[model samples]
Structure formats: C-alpha cells, structure tokens
Target chain A: MNPERMYDALDRITRVRGVRGAMVVSAEDGLVVGEAVMEGVRGNAVAALAASLAARLGRAAGAAEAGAQRFVHLQAEVGAMLLMPGADGLVIVAVTDQHVNVGLVRLEMQRMVEDIA
Target chain B: MKARVVEPWLLAPVERFVRESGARLTMVMTPSGQVLAQYGFTRAVDVMSAAALGAGIAASTGEIVRMLDEPDFRVLNHQSAQHGIFLGRFDSRRGPLLGLVVYGEDTSIGLVQLFFEDFVADLEEAAPAETPRGPVLAADFERDLNESLATLFR
Candidate 1:
C-alpha cells in the first residue's frame, strides 16, 4: 500500500466539514494502521469498529454471491461512518456528521482507494 | 442477534435492487449488527461479523455524540478499485434499520444509491420495525462470538 497516498486521502476526509475523524485500518484483522482526527473523535475506536464491520460484511457479501465487499457507510441519529477497502488488507474509515456531503466524500474516497490499492 | 427474511413484500424490491444495481450483495440489518435479510452471503459467520461491526460503529458513533453534544453522523459510503459499498439507516415502525450494499466493477455508487432508496421505502412499508431491543447480554456476546468463529473456519 502507498503510505504517502493513504495519508493524503485521510487528510482530505478530515478536512471536510462535519467530518470528525478518519483512519486506515486492516480489514483482515481489526487494527488501525494510520489515522487523523478532529477534537472529540476517537480514531482508535472508529478504526476497530469499522474494520470489524467491513470484515464481517465482506464475508456475508461473499456468501450471498455479492462478490468482494468494497465500500461501507453507516448513518445514525447522531453521525455516520464511511469505510473503503485500501491496498492489501487496509480499509479506510471516515466519521462524519449528518450535514457532510456524501456525494463529494464518495468521489474523493473512490480516487483515494484507486491510488492506494 | 437473529436473522429474518425481510417481509415477503419487500423481497421483490430487494431483489430488484440487486438485479438492477448489478450489485453482488446487499444486506438490511439492525444497527446492533443483526441480519434482517441478506443477499450473497454463503456463511452465517460472515453475516454475524458484519452485523456486529455495523452495529458497533453505529453504537460507537452514538458515544461520540454523547461526549460532544453534537448531532450524530449519517450515511456512510466507501469504494475500492473493484467494488463499492453504501450503508445508511432509515426509521420504520419497528425502529431504525441499516442498509448495506456491496457492488463491484459492474456497477457504480450512483446506481446503488438509486436502488437503496427504493429498497428502504419498500422495507419501511412492509416491515414496520418494532420497538428497539435492549443490549446484548455479556454471556450472549461470548456465545455468539464463539459460534461465529466456528462458522468462519468451516
């Protein structure tokens, strides 16, 4: 995986308005390899949960004949999570508020994944 | 957690979402990681893991909101060279439901979004969610974890 490019992608996500934090995680085994965050956001916890979710969903997706799991996003009353598979076993996760522009985030994340994968 | 066959009326739309979106897999589950209905998952363990993680992230985000006093986040989307995924929540009479879609080179995120909205509407109408359940007990967690691990290996 391209470490430099990963940092760049994470930087862009963190810069978005309402985004609390972002991290690069290992999809195979839940772990955060790299991260960036704004105040009040816990990068470690986000990475662990995001990575686990992606991994879990990836397996289900595979069984359902859905092919390889690619992207994951979670929305709630309070916030949201965006996860993208990166180079090797790495997955990128971003935490954002309700107001964040999802279209723009997806577009950038798409490019970032391409660069790192 | 448990798995249910998302109401029969909702199957048509769910099927349509996969067929039209060219998505390989899709899942409608609870925030706490319980599978309501799933497409393309061959193993139960995988579904178990997905639901747990999806719900875990949602729950963890809630923690962030409690600490910061800001509104919670919404809508999460991710993409890779070969696949794309989208996760979102919508309320039903039952409560809140999480929708997850995974697509590959054959489709785009825009297409997935289009179908996901349709699926959500159908889901709400057919499966009016019940009141949310309480937290999973510690003992249940351990038992569930062991079961999922065994399934993953097999």
Candidate 2:
C-alpha cells in the first residue's frame, strides 16, 4: 500500500476537530499497512487493535441484525475510535478526543475512505 | 496467549453462530488472542496466529480510543473477492470473548451482523452465573489449549 496516499487521507482527518491520529490497517492480520499517526501514540498498535475490535464488532453487528457494519464508532469515557472500510481489505482507524465533533469527523473520514480506495 | 479454563457452555453459541450465519468457519477466542473454541480452521497455527493478531488489534485500538479519551470501537467488516470476514466481541459470565468468522457466497455481512447480536445475548444468558469476570490464568494456557483441541478434533 502507498503510505503517502494513506498519509494524505489520514492527514486530512487529523486536521479535523479533536482528531489525534489515523492509520490504515489490514483486517486479516491487524497490522499497520500505513499510518499518519501522531506522537505519544503507537499507530502500529492502533492498527492491530482496531482490526480486532472491528472484526468482533462486525460479528456482533451481524449477529445482532445490525447489517454490513461498514462503519464503527467506539465511545469511551476517555475518547473514541472510529473505523471505516478502505480499499483492498483495509480499514481506516481514527482516534479523537472526548467531546470532539464526531459527526463532522465521521463525514470527513467517510469521504476519505472512498478517496483512499 | 489468551488463557482460560475450558467450559462446555462456550461451544453452544459458537456453533449456533456458524450455522446461523452460514459461515465456512468460526473461531471464538479471547481479547488476548487465545482460541477458546474454533470451527473451520484446519490448522492449529492458523488459530494461534489469528488469535494473537486479534488480541493485539483489540488492545491497540482500545488504547487509542482511551488515549483520545473515548471508550470503545464495536465492530469491523472486511470484504474481498473470495469471501468476507466478521469480527467482534461477546460478554459471558466468565469474561469477554472474541469471535471471528469467514463466509463466502453463501452469506453476507448483514446477515452475520444481525445474527451476532442474538448470539451474544444468548451467550450472556448461557454463561455460568457464578463465575466472576476477570483475567484468564497463564498457567492454564496449555491445558486449555489441549482440552479445546481435543474437543474440536473429536
């Protein structure tokens, strides 16, 4: 995968409100195919973890009758993680601070997922 | 390794999930990447690799959310030419369990996601009520692996 192109997409998301980091990951192996992550946070780990959580949540969505699970937003007390499908069996994971404008970030990422693909 | 004592009850939901979703294979593991129950994987190493990667990805993403002051990310879907994959979590009285599924033309992600919710709820009800949620012991890894393999292979 092209890290530069992935970085460009991630870079745009990171510019959004409360966005901290972003990366492209392989869903199959939980490895970082590319990243535009920031300091103090491990992008590799994020890619790997997001891969697992996304898979599990996808399964959960399936079992729950939630449908394709194209997008996932995990809200925690601290912040949130958002995942979207990208080109070629890849996922885009974004980290944002609590109270971030989630709606806007999601919209931007949604576009980015397509753009990157 | 994701370690835990093997219980017979865990298999029920897993089996149901496979049949209900028309998955070619299914694996129920831990957040730490240990296979608690698996169906469709031909090799033990495949399970091990998947579990490890699953656990690592879960941990990493969970931490990222926490770092950004968020709580969690719930589900993920992957599509390709040959097949599709679904992964997510379920809570039992014992602890949280991870599920991985692979399906081909026989099923779609929507069907799998729809059924996954029911599987989790059923699993929650079926889990032994007395077992408090906590970490699995490392010492039991080998024994747990052996027992689970024995059951699957049988």
Specify the highest-lDDT model's number: 2
Q: Individual DockQ of the candidates?
A: 0.03, 0.03
Cα displacement (Å) at residue B100, model 1: 1.5
Q: Model 2: what TM-score?
A: 0.51
Error of 2 at A7 (Å): 34
Give the winner by TM-score.
2
> Could you give the CAPRI-style class of model 1?
incorrect
- Candidate 1 Cα outliers beyond 4 Å, as residue runs: A1-117, B1-10, B62-70, B128-154
Across B116-138, the per-residue lDDT of candidate 1 in tens digits comes to 66677767667644656667887
Residue-wise lDDT of candidate 2 within B1-154, one digit each (tens)? 2112246777677777777767787777777776767777776677777778777767777788778997574666688888987778666665677778788855556566766777888778877776554555777776676666665555
Weakest 10 consecutive residues of candidate 2 chain B by summed lDDT = B1-10
- lDDT tens string, model 1, A11-35? 8877888888888876643457878
